[model samples]
Target: MIGCGIGGAAAIIILVVTMAFPGSTTTTSDSSILVDPTKEKQSLFTLARVMIQNTGNIPLTNITIDYGGGAKDFIPTLKSGKTIILSPPDGNSLQFVRVTADGGIDVYKAYREPVAMPGMMGS
Candidate 1:
């Protein structure tokens, strides 16, 4: 009746006021760098030549490059328009590469299929 309606309205107002304040939320800044990877084939092995380019106006430092999950390395710094090349253990053998820059991260994946030779059968 009248008492029940007043109680429900008071509860709803209290709930709305409780939700109006900011609580456990957080904010993060993210950024990225440019990366290029090329495949190199040797007599018996293949290699990946990666070029990391800093295109942003800010100078990127303490950059990390992860070649799949097997290997990782760090670069001291990369100024704008600067580039660095990296050769993984084996060219094109790794399926993924991850680069962590100043405030952002980038992941690159390569999926390659072998082309059939003149007389090569299925696969």
Candidate 2:
């Protein structure tokens, strides 16, 4: 009887601790950019939808997005904490993306397909 009570108490304590600290948090930098691609596949032979966010303190200007094979797009300004979604030009493969802007902001990311995971909780 005493062992069962102790075990129950321990389980409760573990549960409380887990609830207190569930997951880790992430913070962005002062001059950072986020480039996220949608998980679903694109139809009509177009590139996947991509999200571009100015996760920075200051506004970005003269932003240029270069999709592979001489395809590109331009954005005059992207204010701080702003997000935009764009699709590459038709006939351009979703191989990679290179972004450049004023103030020496440059980023290059390769496209990768999302994987399916079988689980109740995701990370």
Candidate 3:
């Protein structure tokens, strides 16, 4: 009877410790950029930063970008970078986004038309 109680206590402790933090778990970075949904002024325009990470073991290409809710506005290719940005849309575009290497995509609702930039403004 005393041996049974001891075994139970040992099992409970082992279970708690292992369940606290699983050994085989994988962690990922925040890896996200948040921006306001309002339109940016041309006078206050800057290049939005975009991060391009390999993420996977192999390289990827033909990343598509679409904005204003149109798949036709996608970029054919995008490379890995630390920051990516674009000016607000010209018309009724709801979101802007970039595609990931695994065919996954991310979109943003920031305000920028013609993809505002410091030097590219009023071009």
Per-residue alpha-carbon lDDT of model 3 for 37-113, expressed as tens digits? Answer: 33334455533322333333233445444444553333344443333344434454444443432343344433333
| Candidates' C-alpha lDDT | 0.62, 0.71, 0.41
Off by over 4 Å in 3: 1-38, 41-58, 82-84, 87-89, 94-123
Candidate 1 vs candidate 3, lDDT winner: 1
Residues forming the 10-long window of minimal summed lDDT in candidate 2: 20-29
Candidate rank order under lDDT: 2, 1, 3
Higher-TM-score candidate among 2 and 3? Answer: 2
What TM-score quantifies how close candidate 2 is to the native fold?
0.63
Highest TM-score among the candidates is held by which one? 2
**TM-score of each candidate structure, all chains considered together:** 0.56, 0.63, 0.31
By summed lDDT, which 10 consecutive residues of candidate 3 come out lowest? 23-32
Kindly give the number of clashing pairs for every candidate: 3, 0, 18
| Runs with alpha carbons beyond 4 Å of true place in candidate 1 | 1-32, 90-92, 111-123
Which candidate, 1 or 2, has the higher TM-score? 2
